[model samples]
Target: MNKKQKKMLIRILISAALLIGFNFLPFGGPLRFILYLIPYLVIGYDILIKAFKGIKNRQPFDESLLMAVATIGAIAIAIYSEVADHENGDYVEAIAVMLFYQIGEWFQSYAVGKSRRNISDLMDIRPDYANIEIGGKLEQIDPDEVEIGSVIIVQPGEKVPIDGIVIEGESTLNTSALTGESLPRDAQEGDEIISGCINMTGVLKIRTTKEFGESTVSKILDLVENASSRKSKSEDFITKFARVYTPAVVYSAIALAVLPPIVRMFVMGIPAEWGIWIYRALTFLVISCPCALVISIPLSFFAGIGGASNAGVLVKGSNYLETLSQTKCVVFDKTGTLTQGVFEVNEVHHNEMDRDDLLEYAALAESASSHPISKSLQRAYGKQIDRSRVTDIQEISGNGVMAKVDGIDVAAGNSKLMDRLGVKWIDCHRAGTIIHMAVDGRYAGHIVISDIEKPHAKEAIQLLKKAGVEKTVMLTGDSGKAAEHVAADLGIDEVHAELLPADKVSQVEALMKRNTGKGKLAFVGDGINDAPVLSRADIGIAMGAMGSDAAIEAADIVLMDDDPIKISKAIRISRKCLRIVYENIWFAIGIKLICLVLGAVGIANMWLAIFADVGVMIIAVLNAIRALFVKNL
Candidate 1:
């Protein structure tokens, strides 16, 4: 709690002590009225001041207005009972009511502060400064001060300052900060590192290709800050309802105060007695304030969004959160999404030579190279080659690597690499391309390299259906056969293959047409081409681990982990959070309904009406706080 909350708490404690101490004493008459005033002033000071300000501003139709009317009515009752009825003070009820109402208001403020703090913590992922190279000298500068094309040195255990290319040095980066993936990714010379990733080890000197404001980290912070302003359908309705609700209730309270008194004076035999009905009318205003409903409902949404941010999932706003809860259809992109974006040597084909020999020579030739395909070959070999036994290394971009291993002119790469080496053709029809190796200028063997599917891919499909996704689809630019094979393996219901980014968008549009479309359809992707489709879908979910900025920006929801299972998990969290919000809304309304009927009939007094207002708010606020504990989701 802040200093203000702390002070309020202290005041509440003092008032409680006074109220309890006076309860046992034989304090009666004038002395008892003074006892009640202590708690009343302790709790209702700020509220009374705020009410007076509203009146001065000529906008006295808020919750404070309701509270003021209710509080004054209690004091009036105390005075009337003492004067006319020859009774002791009833101001204890008045003070206790105001005290409870203040407690509820303080709780709400703290709850809102907690929710805002949650998002603030997540926004802290962005780095504040960067080590920039100026005139060949490294200098620390504010991230905002750094411009494009500046070299930024990111050392071990430090965050990458801006999205840039690695001009020098190599390291492993733990990208959980940006992408929820726990695995550390290998970064080498020329590889691009987005801002906010921690360099686990090794010195990386990067050239800042984007300005600080335009970097990946800045955009993320900006997105989170503006998220709450955009409203979901439920939130929008609540806002609009509250606009008309306050004035309507105030008028209703007026009607209750006036209409009954007039009827008793002229239409009935009884003389007009304003005191009894006016007090009830004030109670009616207190019960009808709707503070609990207005504050807690939006607070629930805020807490839900905050909870999601803690899990590394960024839902743009309550609108996206609401859409995610209603999602029934999920579509995914193939490469770098359902499967590991990186390519690797899955199989090695050797017709004459041993498989081990074919791999050893291939690793030696490809070791010095930096391309993703080369790295896969080197990893597949799984051992270091004797550099002393190699000579005549050459690189052919878009082809393969060539070298001399133990005086034999060896070439290992794609079919392009083999054709350049003038090697013989080996007929092989397979799912992925076999990298044909040429040993001594003759056909040796082909090393088949391809993107491997994520281990949880199939399980993610089952989980999605189990978690209430009605349909699953795959849309990709890969070969039709490859797309079908992946979709079949994963048990996805629909597959659209050999599509460009634009085609993917159209396909998604067509699917949107096919479904009754009651619920939203979300597209999941992590590649540049997938960005367009990701934007077109009702809610775009991006794989943050490998996702491009285009995809992340276009996406409504971003899963920090590349795991597709997180999608279902996100949906589950949203449904649960939203359910809690609805529960608070109903709880508050139910109490108000009972209190409204009772107060109008004169059975419910000021304290009971305060319970209907302040007690309901406290309970509802407590319920909203439960959303922050949904990290177990």
Candidate 2:
């Protein structure tokens, strides 16, 4: 418990002891009233001050004001009964109301603090400093001071301070903090290591590629810190409901006190029973406090976001989480999202020259491009590339590259590129990507590269169907044969192939129109070209690790580990959270309404009103905390 909570606890115990001990004394009249006033003031001074401040600030429509008015009115009636009828006044009910209200407030504070700590511990990936070797000695400095291309030494058990490529040494990295997976990943020379991973086994020398502010840890922290600022539709409705509900209940309570006694005295010619009506009005006011709906609704979303972060799913806001629960159509980008995106040369066909010679020519001609197909050819050649061997490289956007290798004109691309160059090329009957190659005025074979599917890709599609997703579509820039093969293997409902970046956006728009009112459509992508479509979809899910910076920037939810299975897990988490939110909403409001009607007709009393206010808040808050336990879901 915090200092404030401990002090409140002490005050509650002291006030309860006083209220109990005074009941045994033989006091009467003014002495008894004075005795009870001590405990009442002890338990309720802060509430009275808050009510006074609200009135002074011209904003007196909150729970504190309702509490202050109800309790103080009950005390006034007690004094009236003691003076006018020679009876002892009862003050226990007023003190009990304040005491129990404070207890409920304390429970709420503790629950929020616990949720914040859980989220804080899960996202505690910010590195304190970076180590740089200068003059044969290591010096630790702020991570913000590290610059691009500067070499930093990450020792065992220390965080990698910036995103960079490993230059020397080898180590096992504990990536659980970033990915929420317990498996340690291996990093060696030439491996790309992002920030916020701990070196577990050996030392590593890394050359920084990005600034500290642009690192993964900084972006994640920024996302989490700003999450609560975006409210859900349910939260917005509760805010508007509270604004109108509080004042309406205050006016109704006033009518319950004054209007009925006036009707009985003037119209029915009976004695005016003002005390009974006034007591019922106080009970009605107590029952009308909206603490449960106001506090628990936002807390549920906060807990849900925290739980998702622990599971490697980073939702940007409660609004996105809410929309994710209603997603019925899921559109996927095939290359990096559903597949491993690691291309390998599966076969070389129709070679007019030696296989290694054709591969070397193709690698040399396309060495300047960083596309996956280019990298696959370079890997196939398995030799260090010399830039001097290639000259006059020209890249065509949709075709391929034409360059001079070894003083000979070399062309390496698809069949479209060979057609553009007026060189008749033979097509391969393959389900993978085909790269056609041509030597100076001669046809020189082709290289077939294929991408492997992710281990959980098929299982992820099945889980989405189990989670009630109606349609699953795959959109890719690959050929129809390659795209359809993967789609059929993974049981995807639809496939669109040979699309550009703009075409992907148009496809998503057409799909969105097809599912106009059925449910929302989500687009998942990882490359820079997918950024436009990610922004155009109803919800954009980005692959954080190994994904382009532009795509992550445009996405709403980021899967930290770049796993397709996390998509289904994220959707399930959203549904569970929304379910809990609605449950608390209906439960709290239903109980309050039932008690309010009973209080108005004199069937309920102060104790029942206390249950309607504080008891309901405690139950709703406990229910909201259930959103944090998503591991089993």
TM-score of each model, in listed order: 0.79, 0.95
Top model number, lDDT: 2
lDDT of 1: 0.80
TM-score (C-alpha, index-matched) for candidate 1: 0.79
The global C-alpha lDDT for each of the candidates, from Candidate 1 onward, is 0.80, 0.91
Candidate 1 residue lDDT tens string, 1-633 = 899989988888888788777777665677777767777788788888998999999988788887887778878877887878876657776677677777788788887987788667754678867886678887878988877887889988788879999999989998765654567899999998888888888999898888878877777777777788988888788778877888898898889989999999989968778888888888888888888888988888888877777677777888999889988999998776788868777788787899999988888887777656667777887776577888899876546678899899888766656676667667556665357789888888887766778988899899889988999999876555667878898899999875656788899999899876468898888845577787788888887443356756678887766777788878987898889878987788888999999999999987788788888888888888787665566
lDDT per residue, candidate 2, 1-633, as tens digits? 789978988888999999899878776798998899998888899999999999999989989999999999998998998899887888888888888888888889988998898899988888999999999999999999999999999999999888999999999999887778898999999999988889999999999999999987788888888999999999999999999999999999999999999999999999879999999999999999999999999999999999998888888899999999999999999988899889999999855599889999999998999998899999999999999999999998767899999899999987778989999998888998888898997889988899999999999999999999999999988877889999999999999987777889999999999999999999998836688888899999987443246755889998888689999999999999999999999999999989999999999999999999999999999999899888887
* Model 2 bad stretches (over 4 Å): 132-140, 149-151, 406-409, 440-443, 544-548
**How large an RMSD does model 1 have?**
7.3
Task: In angstroms, give how far residue 462 of model 2 lies from its true place.
Answer: 0.5
